[model samples]
Target: MKIKNIILLLCFITGFNTAFANEGWINILNEGGNNKGILCTPAIQKAIEKASKNGGGTIFFPAGNYLTGPITLKSNITIYLDAGSVLKFSENFDDYLPYVEMRYEGIMMKTFSPLLYAKDAENISIKGRGVIDGQGKAWWNEVYRIESAKGPIPETKYQKMWTEQNKGIVYSPYYQRTIDKKFFRPAFFQAQNCKNILIEGVTFQNSPFWTINPVFCENINITGITIFNPHSPNTDGINPSSCKNVHISNCHISVGDDCITIKSGRDEDGRKYGIPTENVTITNCTMLSGHGGVVIGSEMSGGIKKITISNCVFDGTDRGIRIKSARGRGGVVEDIRVDNVVMKNIKEEAFMMNLFYDKNTVEEPVSERTPIFRNIHISNVTGTNVNKAGTVLGISEMPVQNISFSNINIQATEGFTLNTTDNVEFHDAKITTTLGSSFKIENSNNLILDNVASMKPIANTALIKLTDVSNMMISNNFPMFATDVFIEANGAKTKGIFLKNNVFNNVKKVINKGAALNAGAVVE
Candidate 1:
């Protein structure tokens, strides 16, 4: 009987321990003096520190505006802002200039002002329907005013806020601000060298600079998040630099700059580190009024590889899916797949790869061989009011290989302009254009046109122009404007020109230098 009583006592202790471990609710408003209205500056931080010291738990921010600045997240913590809670940054820049180690603007300079920042923390999350607004009016206005005067150079430094002191020499901007440049850095949420981050169900708006930047992090998941910054200049959404295993889904992002950018580093500073950005997936998102729907790099010094984008919408953007890298950026961008997209009112080309952005005539442009964009499977793409149909500007030396376009319909102003590329297959690609030829190919080899058609050209030129090509074959093809069918290859080296199973109404024969072996086969 005594032993039975001892067991009952043990059961009671176990139940009490479990209850104590679960009930760790620490409210910031209750920790300090009666300063209500959701003041989370020092009060909430103190409560969080105290709770973390004891053990880790959820520190709740109830509904209302919580004015805070630079709240660092620690290990084993989950900050759940209850629906209707608004975490706003302090307007004063002095509060954010704590001097941290951060990478900004393709350079590793020092400054302050990331609303929520944490480094090397494990199992951290910023989840809820709350809002983290980086009151960026002051910073935005200053950047606008400076950009007007200086013209296209970044003028802010944001790395000093995280670390103790700044040691590296930053490239000086052309002009200086009257206020401090180091104190004016801007990022809403910047997490570095972290693991296992889950940021979901938040409305992030109006950042001073790039909205969400997570660098060198892993095992990250960002879902159901909306980042909106309608203001101009320096408003990029969610740039994951040098990270691994990232998944961004079910998000609505419409910013002023590039909607989502992937970067390893840029220029000499980025090359010094030599860490490539890899293995990222962005799916099920809607973009409005950004530079590009998904951009790879102009600042890709380290390298970028293995990225997949699926099930997205690009409405009224400059370019739909753009891969932009210059000469100084010596990296390889390969294995990129974009599938199942809908575009409306894209002002520029739906797909563009510019290997020579800022090429100079005097000096050879700083350019890597237009990186191989193969295995890029694009399907079920429907578009309206596109300016340019598509562009494949391969390097002057070697071609961009193994690119396939499947099941695409575009109402464009201009059609495909392909040059110096091979092994490009177009399956059921119908592009309606009002200017230029239906297709223009130059310095190319082994091009297969299967079920490719163009309608009623306005330029009164040939439907398809083949110049300086080799081993060309046209089979089962229809050209609407057969005014100049099969323009002669003046300097082209044709091994065997095969024209078979083709149906042309007004076009009977092509202008060719070689012999048409089977001319009377259809209408001799």
Candidate 2:
């Protein structure tokens, strides 16, 4: 093709002027004839470097399968993949050698490079209707081998070890230890400390670790992407860690881990950085077959706030709207709102806030390491065929507070469970369960259950069970038919329980275990 004609064609294809178009289009195939059989890591890296030096342009990948290793992305560059293109990463672990500065499980360390990585860059993007396959089977097999050799993983062992190794420099408990960085796996796409990032219209598969990870980034916009990494370990779809102003929409994610997880950092590293992941919005996404549809950390020690999740669908996930943290990982998770969510076939709880993640049982004094969860509002959510409706398991030292749920409906095998929570309200909630009480409250205070109904009638079970609860107001609730008791309270701490205007039909008793005999307890 003539130079002028080729320039015009490139301009038309990229929808830009001739000068801007020709300068930006660096076709890798033209530079090095689509090296499908050989590893094209060096050639692609050269192309990116050349384009970046020539004032930042687009490195175009035409229709071919380019097998590569880790490729470091440059600033002011866009990786545009053509329709029939596939940038498949090499399976050889040695290719990702010479560990780079990255975060492994929220801990900052020198580790293997991700398939596509950028750090301290600006105006970077990966947009195309093409596929980026991580080819992560080898990585997954290695992890399995390690687990098989290391019998029954301890939950806090690694976190404790990492914290101990990096003590004084970080936080948590002070202990002397050393950590081996060999077990770190690479992510598919990770951009750290980048700004004005855009990722759109791409399909990702077989990630060794998290699919799309943006750490300490700002103004990230990810839209119209599809992530598929079924049955792969740690293949979280999108994990935005310590990022701000992130907007994710129109994405279809089905991964082995959480579909979309918001994080800051892990225990001490998180506290050291102390950068909260805030002002995020996720909408119009489809989540299928993951740990959680939208999760906010088992790793959020750096805090997370001011997030909104709306207009999403979760199908066949283990849980939906999961917020998990541990005792040592102390940070505030608040000001979150979830609305207009629909879920089906959830394997576990539809909504959960678990402060005791990983079975952490270390009894330490209440200090900066005590995690706090409060001010969460959920409305207009519906779920069917879930194993459990929800769980709010907070610690005794710091109870989860000021959570409200309205217009929510769920069908589950077990009902909602709240422990060590305070000032919670559930209004217009219809929870139907095949077994167990519709609501189980334990060691909680100042709860209001208004207009809540148990749709399915189960025999020999109370619709609501309370233990060591205080200052509870249960009003306008519709108890199921054949329920043995509408409300049952036990333990000496169960006091000030007021029940009024509740409809009890076919119930053997209104209050069981002589809970109404307590002082200041009224049932009318």
Candidate 3:
């Protein structure tokens, strides 16, 4: 299908009216009903209610600064802002009180409030060329202070005292419990369990917490949206938790946290929910200055599958593409495809697979890890100024298998470091390092390096190191380094090693004259 036709099909599938859609526009004027430079939340809500009653339409905010309180959007509504529309939140924290049904810290516990909310709605949207500012300095500072205190703060006293002090409300089952889950107020826009929704062409800023959260939703389409929140704490942009059939495209996200996070649930509660977030596609986006550009499963206990991310740019982030899951997560993240990504100035690893995350919790250093990441393909990538090229920390039991990296050119501060088991393949991949060795393989096996090229490092770095590896093939390889290759196989079974049509420069000689290097294991 052609691109336009595909988009049209997506629109049709997503229930978007290309034409003949009513222009439902709402304008909030001052008390005197003058149409400029004022905030009228009550008036806007009245307008939205009136419009919804009369077969829903768009609530338009014209080009001006309109300071308002928390407004609830109704079903069959589209809130549109004209260009230059600046919808500012009221600085008085009391305005967002009484709490709501929200998720905090991976728990379904509720507290405080969100800036804009729509619950159990159908065919809703918030789109336009405008800005929604969440005035989040007060809340972000509080979370940071709590985190720095180090001890578990009492949830009841905290929420009650904060509410009594900040003029908010406490609405959690832990409302009676002393030790409650730390609940910070949510971001500029949060919707729960809505269907056939869209949020396009809006600029969200300075969120109190995670921005644009769509939880337990279905058939959602978010396009042409720009989220910019540089506040502290959990200010993630576009977290689609437990949602199915979500498509996010043509968006620009630059936040203090993860740019796009996919979560099924968190910890035990997620496993109990047992609803896997599946069939999501993210394309044509630019992510900058986040913890991870596109992340999945730091809180993914419920399995996630069938995700495709293409034609994206990850710039100035801590990580480009990351999949992080800890030990207790009994979920499988499989069948993912990432193509045509361009990354620059990645502060950390360009591609990271951390199956053993948050080592602070696991006291005895878990050697046997799971949560397999298999049959994943990443291709047509060009990266520069990468801190680390790749780090795969797979399980000792089930190594990350059937993974391929093809047509990749990366220039990084450090090169590939592989740990644990492996049935990995690196085909048509080139790496130029600045500090570390080209490849470091420890306790891995059945690896194939086909048409791999490594540029000589200016620093003293080794070309390749294979320790306790079996059944490996290094054919059609070209490497440049300042030292020799090291292959040390302990009491492990032996398979053939082949080094045919290989080229090495600077100072490298073949030295794997062992029995494990038995069949097709010849170096020319």
Candidate 4:
């Protein structure tokens, strides 16, 4: 089908009325207003059923506090909350009874219903200047209590144990077993297998799990949303899993986990489904106090492609632009472009691509489960007060390839580090570090450094260090007033290195080691 026809079909399927013609608007208070602090799930569900039966309309909630349990959304429906209104989820876990199909931490399984959920629907939206409070303190305390009892062995290990325990039940190696329903907290909003969805102008807070999660959906638009989940665990701002054609803009996110995360699936289940999240665009967003401003995967086994993130600001985040996956999760992540990003006070590396996430470092033979990262380009980025400039650590068997950076500036305590990567290039890059070498390359190949330099001179540190690297070209660089030792190469594998048309000043001796001193290897 053509794209326009597909969108029209989605609208028809979801009962979206672009004109908002003579459709009826039903108010829950008029239907049955229970102002006694009682459960309003039944009344709200009735109103929604009525609206859906009447060919879809708006279910309006005026200025009041409505306590409810899980609410399911229908197609062509809009849930509008006026200013000074709040939809507060009940704290009682029993309210969210009956399991629902949902993805938890990249694993798809049956669990408690999300606070607000929709499945197999189209053209649905939730828009308003109101608040949807998860009242997640109780759930957070419950999870913490369980973790305290389980002891500290890293969350992934515990998750793996749970996944193994339920192997017979879920019939998938990657599924997590919820020993008890109360222990598993649901997300605030989850939509699955839907299209033409819109979530705008809403304030979401204190989510039990991820704030806004959409799985296996398409054509989702989220804008002007504010999410604040402070000091909470696993409360990522927005996570779009196995989705396509997604656009997120003008959002302000501050959460305990990653602000915006793109995921496909996890482990065996992910490989089994073989769905990819593609054609995503995120722009003009402000992120604060999250694990990562924009994260690709720790659970991307299904693959991800054609993602663009631009014109974003990240402040006080643990990391910026982090892509992480382990060896066991085999997937391809490619064609990622990020530009015009500004970051300040990053707690860790400004840009990090780590293929070694799990603790197991043992070498294994190449298989279908080997992760691959390639064709990533980042440009026009600036960072200050960063702990580390960047790190690219790829696997030995399938090294990360074709990564490039241009017009980048970083001020940090340490510089860039590359390991087991190939075909990486840096152009017009300036790195200022307080300690350690400005650039460290190990077991990499085909590296091109053009017009790259360190911002200031530092004593007792080499400006660039290469070990076991080959096929490198260092040209047209300004190493003036930098470290005394301009470039140092160690290990016998260092060969095919050519440095030309570079300026060296202030009593610096170049080529400290390995590569033979020749006309082609070094030219002053």
Against the true structure, whose TM-score is highest? 2
lDDT (CA) per prediction: 0.71, 0.87, 0.75, 0.86
Q: Whose TM-score is higher: candidate 2's or candidate 4's?
A: 2
TM-score of 4: 0.90
Residues 1-524, candidate 3, lDDT per residue (tens digit)?
69999998888866656344534554455222233546566787788888889888878777877777788888999888889888877766667776676755455655656788888998998888998888787777776666576686655454674444434332323233323334457667777788998998999988888888877889989999998887466799888888899999999999999999888776666776767788999999999889999998777767788899999999998998898876666577888899999999999999987777755434333332235567777899999999999887776555777777888899998878887756788888887787756677777778888876666544333456565666788777655445454333323444455566666554454454444444433334
- Which portions of model 1 miss their true places by more than 4 Å? 1-22, 32-39, 150-184, 361-375, 420-422, 455-459, 471-473, 479-501, 506-524
TM-scores of all models?
A: 0.82, 0.90, 0.84, 0.90
Clashing pairs in 4: 14-76, 14-122
Residues 337-451, candidate 2, lDDT per residue (tens digit)?
A: 9999999999989999999885746667888788889999999999999999999998878888999999999999999999999999999998889988889999999999998
lDDT of 1 by residue, 1-524 (tens): 99999999999999999888758766656776122444357876776677678777777777877777678887767777778887777777777765566778666755674778888887888888988787778778765566466454553344233333554544323212422344446677888889988889998888878887887888889899999888667788888887888898998988889888888776666777767778889999998888888887777777787888889998988878887665555666677788888888888888876655545412344354223344455677877788887787666544666677778888888877777677777777777778776567776777776666765544445556666565566677666664445333344244444566776675644554424333322121
Quote the lDDT for 377 in model 2. 99
Q: Model 4, 429-502: lDDT tens per residue?
A: 99889988879999999999998878885776788888888899998887666458878888777778888877
The window of 10 residues in a row where model 2 has the poorest summed lDDT is 173-182
- Sort by TM-score, best first: 2, 4, 3, 1
Q: Assess the local accuracy of residue 289 in candidate 4 as a C-alpha lDDT between 0 and 100.
A: 87
The C-alpha local distance difference test score for the whole of candidate 4 amounts to 0.86
